[model samples]
Target chain A: MNLEIILHAGLATGTVLLFASIGELLAERSGILNLGVEGMMLIGAMTGFSMALATGNPWLGLLLAMLAAGVLSLAHGVVTISFQADQVVSGLALTFLGTGLALVLGNGLTGQNAPLIPNYDIAGLAAIPFIGPVFFEDHSPLVYLGYIFTPLVWFYIEKTRPGMHLRAVGEKPVAADTMGVSVYRLRYFYVFVGGCLAGLAGATISLSVSPGWYSAQTTSGQGWIAIGLVIFAQWNPLRAALGAYLFGALRRAILDLQGPRMILGFVNPLYINPNLGFFLQMAPYLLTILALVIGSRAAMRKRIGAPAALGEPYIRGERGL
Target chain B: MAFPISIAIEKRTADVPRWMPAATSIGSVVAAFIVSGIVLWLIGSDPVRVYGFFVRATFGSWAAISDTMVKATPLILVGLACTVAFKMKLWNIGAEGQFYMGAFFASLVVLVPLVPAGTPAIVVIPFMAAMGMLGGAIWGFFPGFLKARFQVNEIITTLMLNYVAILWNNFWIFDRWSDAGFQMTPTFERNAWLPRLSDLAREYPIFSGITLHLGVVFGLLAAVVVWWVLERSRWGYEIRLIGDNPHAARYAGINIARNIILVMMFSGALAGLAGMSEVSGVVHRLQERISPGYGFTGIIVAWLAKLNPFGVVLVSILFGALIVAGREVQPSGIAQMIQGFVLFAVISSDVLLRYKVRLVRTRADQNAAGEAA
Candidate 1:
């Protein structure tokens, strides 16, 4: 019941969501929205769990997870890029199909155990002793990707040429296309990359944190949280990471604060219900709504920030998304 | 594949050209079966044999027919739910949640003396069913209100509310609703369960082993009522106009936001009725895991039916076959994989069904109007 352990678990949860969110932000910024992250993440988690256990190799598990997700993401690219189906519904359907496929394919691996990736320290960083153990020492290697992606994503979107072009599509796909940028091609690349990151997030759950277990609800609503975080961060990766960690801490705190001996009366009602932990589980959703309400204009200022054709598919020779 | 609920979809709804429908139907079936076949083969199963099992499991016997009906009942009802609200462009994605809520309401009626204890089973069932509808209606209205008042996206709100409803219903059945016995499925009084159709017992032969409750009749009747509402009513015209061209409809004097709220409420009520029927017919009580993601799957059914109520009945049964047959697939894993593939194929075909993918043949199709038409 230590608060720190609870906080660490929450951080792990946030990291899973953060990996996916950062990738999605990259894709959405470039004016291509991918809603299949949930499905991809589920596949990743299942694949990661099975592979890690199957080969007793955590590295392979993470690799397979990413590959699985990356491959599944191709479907989204095909539908949106080639056929011009509405991205919103297509994404929704893809997620369902992906998750269902993962569950069905993963039947033999249920109740299995997974090997945890060994922890490592930054050179000379382990010398910090107490702080390192809590913040760095004992976590899986993939957990660090959460931190790396935040800043890496930030630079890629802000400093890279293709990143700039990607943003241009969101601002004006027609303009980007006129500039000789192939919208479909750019969208496919970003979506595939984003999907791999989502896969990594899922593997982080199975191989790094919960290790080896997979359920249809295993990924739960973290993918949705990533969607919310994109808005909460105002689509900034660095800010998204912060928001994810803070939310993760909140989730952990709820459980840490709960014990059979803990008194309920006189506590805040939101934290007082026996099912407070369960309801608090909906923190990401409530946060999304709250962020939207607080930054209503910020959300609508899509012309300056969001993808020009975020939920609209790109059909060549068509008028618009 | 195809989006079932676009404004452009309805205008082009003339019965597809004779050759196109037949070709597309064959294409889609072949495409679905092939994809499922390939996936099954990877897992070391024969696609041909698995598909045969799927077909037989779904249609080969009377038990299969009734079982498929049982599975399709709520889906049909919920499909009708999505059709009604979707007409106004109100996406009520929370039907699964609403269905669970309906079961909760019906359970309360069974547990609480909302009516006289000696009430006839017939009277009690309908009354409870109505109460269940109200429960879902209320849940539906909140998002409708938010969308109407603040221009909030109902898709996100409706989807989020689903988990809340599921948790709410789950907590009740797990904690307050059940007795001390470790039963996840609560037992409702005999007075609460709806009676089966008379003809079903007498008319059905030995093969039709599954229960044919009154809910099937309700599901069919719901389709008729919904078809009449959407196709014949003046309000239906408004909904249609809103769906096809909301901006023009509004310019010409349509209460856009108000229509959203009304349509959503009606949709939620119908979905709730679907849930109510399930309780009154089969499950007979509120329990954990009340839905098997039916609300979400029902969206596809609504899409496949082209949001037409009568079409919903047909499509729901088709999807229901997969769900039932999926359970009976000779070797479970491969059967499910094929079943799952069929779903994606069905949805994918709908995409091609709705839109024509032409090469960049001319500049004329560059305008919104040209592409839309």
Candidate 2:
């Protein structure tokens, strides 16, 4: 109900999605639709939690998470790009692998807490009323890092030379290859980068958001939501930030509305049967379908900004261009 | 064109031999199991013992074999469902959701008193099956319609719908259908339950304690029907043609959109039947964990079986073994890991079926004049 509470809750929740969507956005822009984001994130979460728990260093955990996921994504690239396997099936397999690996590795870490990512507060910004508490006060350093990276991502895609090449690879791989651009290399690089970011997203959940290593469902469906956010954001990092926050807000609201209703400073419980709370959880997924349906329809009539060569493997001089 | 050595990966000019697929498939499975065995060893478990236990638990006794069949029943149905749509190049990833929808609808038949308590088992069972199929078909229709109408990606739509279906089911079970706060409906009346193999044990002692039910029969029957349709029916021709080349199929005047919807619905109906079968035969009541990822596992089944209906049956049985083995094993995730590896191997092995890769070193000194030299 209040601006400060909502904004605080929304930004805290949104950081995970933001990290994931930006990574996926980058991968998609390079013409590889990696559906294994969820899997990678889960693997990342498990590895990060394990590393952090072992070393008592959350930073090390986060790094290892990115590394593990990057390696997994490379496997995906090899299958989809080099072997010409179906992208969708390969991605799904990657997910299953990640989930299984995470479950196995995470068995020992359940109910155990690892080091938490430290929260930072800006001196001057924290002093400001309403705005300060909502934006700058008592948030994880990862949140600020995400804030800085969002604009950087936008600039990198919009202004840099490699960014232009990335867009070209996604839109017209054959044409890009003809122009001396290495489509294969660019796709491999972006897909790996996406995996790294997904790993960080997982770290964000364990180290900062939930602040502990849990079971296989720790990352839950957040990775899938992030994938949906990529389309909802129209493949734009800046817009993805907004989309993530919107989803974050919806998620936060559901949490606040359920339970004892104390989060809203109300006495009466908002959930009538308490099971009504479960149905409310369906909103984000329902919203994703609606967004895809509408976004794709608009795309047909106008440029909805999808990379033209998305999901298609580019094999040099293969036939039937 | 002669060089000291060169590496080339070229498409094979000739068609692959008939035995290649089976050979590669068996090779892949063996490779996967070996890798998983190594993993098991690394985890401090004796791989041989684990595997031996797996074999014994899945096929050790009549009861164990019957349990495996019970597990395979849904996988076969869902696998057949996926094969149909996938054969037509339609990605029906919503099978999990459709399964839940089917279960939801089937639950209503008994929960809502749609039929009288005294209704014959024969009557109520078929009605529930029909309702379940309808539910799954309707779930499939939305993504099919969207793909046909708006070109929305079916992969995303189907995946998203899965959560929606799951959450919707949870809502009902937690709120209205909870049997004294338990996350399940009350046990169905005996008349509504699918007759278990043990029910026949009254006369035959061998049938005792065998949990196998009519679902396996339904699965086998469905597989035969699917194989017949795909191999012999005119509709199968249209579906196959579209899968091979949609542009050519469209040029040939096939109604691509309608066929996509139809095939997708048919695919969903099978998955729905899987769900209904689970509730009616195995659980005998709608519950929160009605399936343990059977729908997703069915994807692996369909692919591993090469989308052949009979292959689905065989592969489903293999996967059913894994499911049963997982329960008996110390670590449940090991079985899941093997399934995942099997999928990876299956997908990667396709490259071998289509192309041949050979490594050779290119001599830089006199590559062009090497033959003359």
Candidate 3:
């Protein structure tokens, strides 16, 4: 019923997706398409919550979460990179491994309280109108981190010298190799970076955003949604942020739709018939498909596409992208 | 002083030995078990005792074997479903959704009384099977169409549709078809049930209490058919060609887009059959929690079987045992963890197929050669 509150919650929840998609964007930019985001996120959430609870330090928990997920990603790196396995299958295997590991380790941590990341409002910025409250008011430190993280990622991928090298590695590894860039090293590094960010996103959900562990439900399918957002954003961090926030708002609005019976003088079907909320629950997924269609069309029209060597294994003597 | 030892991995110029693939696969499974045991030990459980319990619980008696078989029935179909799509290099991760839709469609035969109430089992069973396949095929067609037309990624699309399909099923079971306010439809009449060995208890008292259903026969038939389709049929050749080399396949005048849609539908149909089998043979009702991740398990089964149809049946039985026994294991995720390790080991073991690994002495002469290389 309240637009402001919903948007505020949207921003907080959107931070989770923002971190995940941006992380995925980094890996894909380096010619590695890791579909293990969901698994990695789950691992992160569980690790963050449990670590915080055991240690009583949210910061240490956050760091350990990233480390755990990053270590897990190395498995993918070894398989797809060193052994030259299929990226899609390896990523899927990574998901299974991550989920299983998290589930095993996170057992009995449910309903236990943990030291969560504290929230604070920016003194002057919080006083501004709608933007002030939604963007700068009482929110987890991670939300502010996301705001700063997006543009920094954009800058690092676009304007920096290493960014050019990163793009070159993805688009034309052979060319990058000829220029003395270590394609394998960069891919591994980026994949690890992606893993760490996905872990951070998971921690955001368990330690900052929602502030508890719900096992698999903690990240739910947000990690997958983040992957979709990467496509919709065309691998751009800024656009990913936009899509993430919009999706967050949409998710929040859907939950709120069942709250009130009357909506602008019209009876809300979702409120009247609770079963109809199932359809409302489906909006985000349906929109992802719609987004994919739009994204695909745009890519075709603009002749913009995925990284040329996105899913290929880079062998030193192989004749390929 | 030079290093005493070094590892070398050289690409194999010659074809791998005939037994290498099989050896690697078996090795991977054993390795996975060892790794899972380590994890179990790390978690403070006795790995040997736990594994012992698994074997005993799954194969302890005829009844346990029958239960495992029931679980394997759906797995065989779903594994075949994954095999067909993965062979074409199309990732149809939505087998879970397709399975649900299949169950929904199968249930429609009895719930809507599509035939009259007293229809014979002969007519009604086949109708239900056909409807189940139809529902699954329909569920699969959208992602296939999207991928073929727009070059959209099938993995994400298929996965997204899974959530939609489950929710769609929920709407019906929760509100429209609730069996006296329970989250399931009313049980189907006996005519809709698949014939089981237990049904012949009057003729053979030894078969009493057996829950093994005709669905197992369906699974066996599906495996043979899938094997034939992949190995003997001309379309199978086309599919393999596309899978191995898409550009070569296109140049050979193969219609890639049409095959994509067809193969996806075929794959979906198999998974749909799995959903139907579970509903008609076991649950006997359309319910929300019918599957305990059979579709997801099927992916691992297919991979473990190396995409062979007969191999799928064997793997499904093993995994079926895992599922059956896993219910009793503590911490609840040991089986899933073992599956993950198996998959990881399997893929990693492919290194043996492509490269020859050796430990070379690196005192003086070898060290010089290594640097020169």
Which prediction has the highest DockQ against the true structure? 3
Model 2 spans > 4 angstroms off: A259-269, B1-7, B359-373
Model 1 chain B worst lDDT window (10 residues): B1-10
Question: Which TM-score value belongs to model 2?
Answer: 0.95
* Candidate 3 residue spans exceeding 4 A from truth: B362-373
lDDT of 2 by residue, B289-354 (tens): 788888889888999999899999999999999999998776657877888889889988888798
Output the worst ten-in-a-row residue range by lDDT, candidate 3 chain B: B364-373
Worst 10 residues of 2 chain B by lDDT: B364-373
Clashing pairs in 2: B5-B361
* Candidate 1 error regions (>4 Å): A121-134, A263-288, A295-305, A318-321, B1-26, B198-210, B329-343, B350-373
Ranking by lDDT: 3, 2, 1
Proportion of native contacts kept per candidate: 0.11, 0.65, 0.65
- State the displacement of the C-alpha of residue B321, model 3, in Å, after optimal TM-score superposition: 0.9
* Leading candidate by lDDT: 3
How well is each residue in A1-321 modelled by candidate 3, as lDDT tens digits? 799989999999999999999999999999999999999999999999999999999999999999999999989998988788999888889888998889899999889999999999989999999989988999999999989999999999999999999999999998998999988889899999999999999999999989887877888889889999999899889999999999998999999999998999999887778999999999999999999999999999999978888998888766865
Judged by DockQ relative to the true structure, which candidate is superior, 1 or 3?
Answer: 3
DockQ of 2: 0.52
